[model samples]
Target chain A: MSETGVIHDIGYQRYTGPRLGRGAGIGALYVHGLRAAFGLGRSAKAKIFPWLVASVALLVAVIVAAIKSQFSEFTFSYVDLDDQLSWMIIFFVAILAPTLVSRDLRSNTLPLYFSRPLRAADYVAAKFLAMVTAVWLLLGVPQFIMFLGAAFTTKTGFKGVWHEIQDLVPAWGYSLLWALLFTSIGLLIASLTGKQAFAAGGIVAVFLMTTPVVAVLAQLPSTTANHLAGLTSPITLINGVGSWALDGSIGFDIGRYGPIYAIEAFCLIVACLLLLLARYRKVSAL
Target chain B: MNIIATQALTKTYGGGVTALSDLTVQVEAGVIGLVGANGAGKSTFIKIMLGLIAPSSGSVRVFDIDPVTETDKVRARVGYMPENDCLPPDVSAAEFVTHLGRISGLPRTAARERASETLRHVGLYEERYRQIGGYSTGMKQRVKLAQALVHDPDLLLLDEPTNGLDPAGRDAMLALIHRIGAEFGISVVVCSHLLGEVERICDSLIAIQGGRLLRADRISSMTTASDVLAVEVSDGADELAVRLTEMGLAVTRDHRMLLVPMDSDDAYDRILRAVTELELHLHRLDQRRHRVAELFTAKETVDV
Candidate 1:
């Protein structure tokens, strides 16, 4: 053995690089939340539920595209696709909203996050934006498939594809409305609990349980109540807004209450978002 | 420069329970220990330092930045390991720490590199890729520490870093903390209820009781040698104690050893002469110093 062996200095090194500010923190959180919603960078078990719903949505889009190509007279527009897949969208939100918000609560990781440069508003905003984008992709991607199906079959050249683009853009907006409303409400419900099961169940219950109230309210022997009953449920509320603003009706009539539906949709989204921000103003004591 | 300074910091919840009452202290950069019992506002003090919760009244500054107004600026330079299970079970330690590093403002590649380096520094090398749920309490604590260090903050606020560890694990953790402070040149404030652990690793001590500052001083000053000599004999300790009392010195027997009060400069000579006259084999003789635990019990006795 050598008598003069030297000891290497492997001490902790200080990072002298540029440290980004709050914007970078929020952006990283947004990226992480979005990946988590789709179970990216997680175990195979985590990917099962998200991909199950996503695959089903993709399968339906393929079937719709095939059907539209086969039947030249088929009038199933891109907006109609979102209307038909509303239940899938609800299921997607139930699965996704909890994964985005409740996991942090369940694991009690908010303190670790808050102890950094990220603020509560930044946290809430990143999560909300992530869920919105996830839901929009779930709906918007399928609508694009339907457009592709129509555009390929059209013999009317570029103008036909341009027409398809026009229809697809409005349908994407309609899907965005669905994304915004469902995400805000679902995230608000999910944020209230740390247990993912309870949050998922509560979110599904809120969305499913309200549709019956709209049905019952529409039957009150008053035309005014029937026109205003869509406000009672988020599902019908979106349909009412779609029918009034996008001129896409899916068996729901808002009558002259188009502006009311628009205002209620807008107000409901704003209120849910505000409530989420308030809920996160202080993380759980743990 | 003082890393943390607080003046009349009071935090009263809505239920009228005061967590911190008029706490005023300034801590310099070193391995400082914050020692207190459960519910003694140690956690509350740390949270206020991190700006996690606002103080009900008064002012608090971390790194000379007001935590309440410039929370982000304060938090940017402070790494905190909370006193709870904050690790997500499903993710590996490497991924989780890297993610937190990114949130703490490191770019993507730097976060990954720092996460690996930190995990290795915390004595977690091959196990960094394993899921944290399968880790032992010691390994989990290492993961938590790794995340806190991955950001390379100027100061560290660790709350009960060795809370659920065995004796050997505790020793390893204390050694790591000591190295982190002494070698890494980063200031640390270790909040713990165990005074022995704090005294073993800290340069200064801050003791709190019932949301009040009991004492704040350097460990050296707090543990200065008391006017007592601890002597151990191979045998005949009882006779030695009796012989010491026969002289002017007061002696107290503690099991096999005798504690003699050093009242004069000749105390050691008197002890040596007593041992020689009694023909007892002197095994060990040393000055008895104050322990950090004495501060708490001493205050209790004064209160009574």
Candidate 2:
């Protein structure tokens, strides 16, 4: 402004165009969350951890397939693949869940999210779905590689390939279940704190630390006590349920305790989802 | 039409802390500054207006819709820049601002296009691709502003946007905000405890104290000039004051200046004559304008 108070024209055009509504807002958030989970649209360094874990899983599957192809007489199936790669899934969840939940909280960015045309439930739902998708990719892609590898290396020709393809039906179901369950529990834990180290460490402690304790507890003489002990580690609970569902011999003996493990796993999943909802509800209220 | 209106809006948090108490005011579309001291409920008022928090009682209407009930509607047309650092470190300014635009309901292509335009307008075109963690404080502030603008909101709720900038950066940010209001015609409600900058850029002000509305009026009315002219001389200010008094002009000494009542026909001429007669170097002679600080003090005493 000059001494005479004449305002100059600095061009800042008003937006007179069409603006999208609430559904588009929710959809955008879902896309952004999924991108952030895999470190897409971020720095190259930010992409390292997720890609490294994914690469390691892929490499293991390839190496396993190579060894199986070389030794044509050895027996292998997708159930055995899931058993062998269970720890990798646990590790993937521990490291990646924090990226989806903790970073936003740590930066106090909830106001930014809430200030948009989105409800708290929408924010939580989008994040949860993105997390499930990320975990599914991590766990499912390797199993897909294993399926393809198994079909090609089969000496029994089309019969062997058909059998392997049939086995993938159960494999994909189990992989999706693992994704849903781990996403719920991991996101619930990660939502508790903004500190990534603490969230990640806590997730690791819950998944890894409970394994040995559950093992010792399962050695009890009583059958009921052994079935109850399987409820401690998510890995064990999932394994127990898988054994019951598939009637396979991978981890625990189903015997009469199969239904008990399945019920406990279902309850745990529901509890984790409920806890996640409650945590986000409190944050939005504030 | 009023851009925002509150009817007996109050917010009382847990443990009996009242952040806002019965703040009822109407704000029109323009550069409106929300000024108050720290912990004076400025943030609380903003959150309620944005529908980020519910009021304990009463109602808030943004763009003529109840924020509590139609929060999504209100938020769809409003963009908010919070008082703290909220950008994720791992993302670049381009990505973060584009993501915010998407979150605000822009399509992917529109978000990307607007993100670049907004970043350029905020003078961050050169560093748009740099990670935000590497940005300076001024750059970070610009990034925050850019995100708020990327959505092309009808109104902007800026909570202490200039909190951490140096004088130069503060000047640039205030200028950008001023243009946003004046040129773009976006209704801006800038929350700041810094009264000077608010006074400089805002057309009207909503001043608060102790969780209550102190006053809301045009900046011109609040800062109307008093009937006094200040005279500053390089030397002999006391002599000048005495000489002015002798010349039948009521004068008072203030630091190195003489405050003469402009009750006469020629206040400026009288001061110039006195300075010329005394042969003292006249540094300045200007009318004593009322400031926002004086307005605040005046309102505080009036409330008492």
Candidate 3:
């Protein structure tokens, strides 16, 4: 028992390495959100809905590829695959959007997030990018499968393969458009509520409830209303834009209102993103 | 240098509800306790320090950087554990903490290594792989703490670190916090309503009430010994009290004990002489010291 005291080193090391800045914070959040969207790095129970939707999507892509390879008369194009899987895309958005933003809101982890080197714009950007990437991969991967099916079945030489690549590139861009529009709208709706169930339900309702409005407006006996009807619902609006820009790939008639559809789509994405940023400016503490 | 400084900081919410008003305080390094009752603006103050919310007026700085303008620079060096339940139930603690570490600007491998180290430091190494939903309140609190410390921050803002824990859990958390501040050489701002816990681990105390600063001083200064002695007798307490009063001492009886003012140098000797003269059993004899709780009670009596 000496008078001198001993302060042992218990091996608590300090981090003196290079700490990344706002870019890294946003990148990490994007990666985390993307993984969480597909229920990666989560529990088995948490993986059920996402995997269920994904497996069905993959199954449809496989069947479409098989049917196209078997019969040359099968008229399913790469872009048409998106149109065919639009319902699955909607379901995927409903499941994925809440997992991206609503879980953070429900768990009240925004304070922990914002307490780091992350700003509100960075958070919204990272999450928006993550959802867009997730949705794009959901459509893009399957479209690539369809491309492979068509590429393998082509009797012509490199020209046919080159033609398939052109169609596949535009279709990938179209899927990106779907990802952008659906993710913005889905995230905006999901960001409003902390309950994932309510968020998922509200997203589906907003997307579903507007289709009837488009139908009623389309049957108004006026050609202008019929041509402009797709602008009412997000699904038809995307289809309208795709048909207009992608050279009538989707048969929905936009008539002379093609530019209007494009303008509306751009404005809708920007508006939703702005609203999402505003919603995160002041997060409610639990 | 002061780790945090605020000058006339005020935050007035919409509908005329003020959360903080003119809160001017400078906090140096060490384990500082922010003690206040509910709705006493403790959380509001911490939020302003973390730059989570903008102050309506006045200016604040952390590490010489204004949090409003240089929030990222300030936040890069500070770690925050919010008061509420912020853990997602679906993810394991290790994954969640490592993700948060990356968000705090650590590299991928460094984040993972530090997450494990901090979890171990908080005594949560074995259970780090379990999902947070199955964790007890104490274990969840440690997970929150691990996330805050994963980046090896210079400052830690812990809002109620021992909140919702059993007695043993509380003592363990307090000891962990003490070790973090004393051994790891990190400045900590622990926001708690329990004054006793604050007094036990805090080097300095800042008590706020109604969004105003009540007192800010060292814990030793705040709880100095008072000029009074407490004596408990197993028997003949009343006779000792009477004898002490007859001998020109102000004695007050409280239950089976007597409180006597130590105004003279021989006060202890005089009390002992009286106890011996009365043949009373000397059960206990000690000096009374002031506690942090007295500040609130003293304020209440003045307001009344």
Candidate 4:
């Protein structure tokens, strides 16, 4: 007999419930189901997602509108629509998955897990993976459409497929990388403050508000826009990625994409370490 | 050997608030009561044992595993229930418990099965499948308990499991705890501010105050109490025990009152004579036995 049954004497044979086809426990599946139904439910989705979709959609429309107008010979094609939606998908996913990571902490659901047999690092890892998977599904489906669209529209269908494969690697890789980074950063903020909004805001503030603000300030006057300064933040790293794909290099003349990847990797490692530290400090004190 | 032992465990929050202080306790393999006033360090002690917080100046071990250095192994042996209300309303009891079990390293099927059975034990059968947000407070507490027990630990740390319940709910919860500790053989560390509640269920008790150990002893070993005694005396409290013992009388202290057994009625004069010689203050010498509550309440006042 398992120790849990003997200790609890609940008496139903352990694991006698409805089974999960996958090797993972029904517990994880149950959590995923609850998240899909309520976490990504009617009330919250409309409020958070439309804005995400709209912003990404607008950016894509502008780029498409500009290209169509600038070069008269370039035909208006369905592949462009695919690319636009794909970007929107990735953008929404990058922002949304980390949003819930902070929410769980603010809600006090974390202590429940800690009181059980799980370790602090395990808890952080589970949450991290859960959030990463959410973003992957949200973005991966839409982005794959570009591959299919190119086959239907362009004369060089194989070339379109090649481009899709090339972009696919980066898009998927970045999604996971960004998910880990965001989750780590968001979790660090969440650990610092129990409030969900504050943690979420910290992520946006670092990525959207602070980095650009500093970059723009550097561009102004006797610019502190120094290379050392520009390379200091999460947003700056994202900016470098944006620059790499768009122009085959960053405007800052930063040495290749290697430095950017290295910076992101460093941030992710630190974020994970911080998460474990916070969990231990909190658990030890609980 | 002690399964859990602490040496002067103390915790001070950042704002100069001391949650626990100098609380030294040893818990073995049975039901043990951790009785104290609210804000008395029960939660603090539990947290420190699980390595949730560092003590200001103390050490702790849960199952011989230092909570800090061997936290994972230590946690594996402990099933903990917090006092506060903390359940995700959207998730069902079974789902919440299953997730916790999986996180504890149980296989998926095992996690789900345990979730089902544990919820049933806590009296949340089919309802375990329903959303927790829709359940009542009593139901919610059951979910909290289920999650704690999902891992099948050796020792269960229950921090006021009946904190906000009504009388019936409290009784039901207490009965379940007794079964877990005595019948199922799980060592229970139950903490509560209510002395009466702990006295009724615990075989041994460790009382704490301001983070210090006030007392620790088996309920029977600690107190000097005798069986039913009936004595008619002018002033006979301490002598009553002697007179009864000589004539084989059951004398016991139930607070300020001293009881002499009716079987020792033949030595009533001796009881009276000894009482006068000792110059002891006599309240009432009754045949009726006194409950543990009166004893603890009186002792608590005297200690304070």
User: Quick one: best TM-score, which candidate?
Assistant: 1
lDDT of 3 by residue, B56-94 (tens): 999999998998888888888898998899999877899
lDDT by residue (B1-304, candidate 4, tens digit) is 7988888777899999988877777877788999878777778788888777778888887777898887767877788888887776666677778777876667767877777878877789889878888998888878888888887778888998888899999998888888778776778889988877877788888887776677788776654443355454444445566755675555566554556654544545656666666676655555443455566567779988
Scored against the true structure, residue B24 in model 4 reaches a CA lDDT of: 73
Error of 1 at B4 (Å): 1.3
Off by over 4 Å in 1: A1-9, A284-286, B227-229, B242-250, B261-288, B299-304
Compared with the true structure, all predictions reach lDDT values of: 0.89, 0.84, 0.89, 0.64
Report lDDT (Cα) of residue A68, candidate 4: 43
RMSD of each: 2.6, 3.9, 3.4, 8.1
- DockQ of all candidate complexes: 0.67, 0.63, 0.62, 0.22
Off by over 4 Å in 4: A1-99, A151-164, A174-237, A245-280, B7-24, B55-59, B222-224, B227-304
* Model 4 lDDT tens row, A103-124: 4555567676666545565555
CAPRI rating of model 1: medium
Residues B1-304, candidate 1: write the lDDT tens digits. 9888999999998899988999999888899999888999999999888888889998999889998899889888999998899999999999999999999989999999999999999999999999999999999999999999998988999999999899999999999999999999989999999998889899888989889888888887776656579999999988888888889778888888888877787999999999999888999999876567876698779977
TM-score of chain A of 2: 0.89
Better by TM-score, candidate 4 or 3: 3
Ranking by TM-score: 1, 2, 3, 4
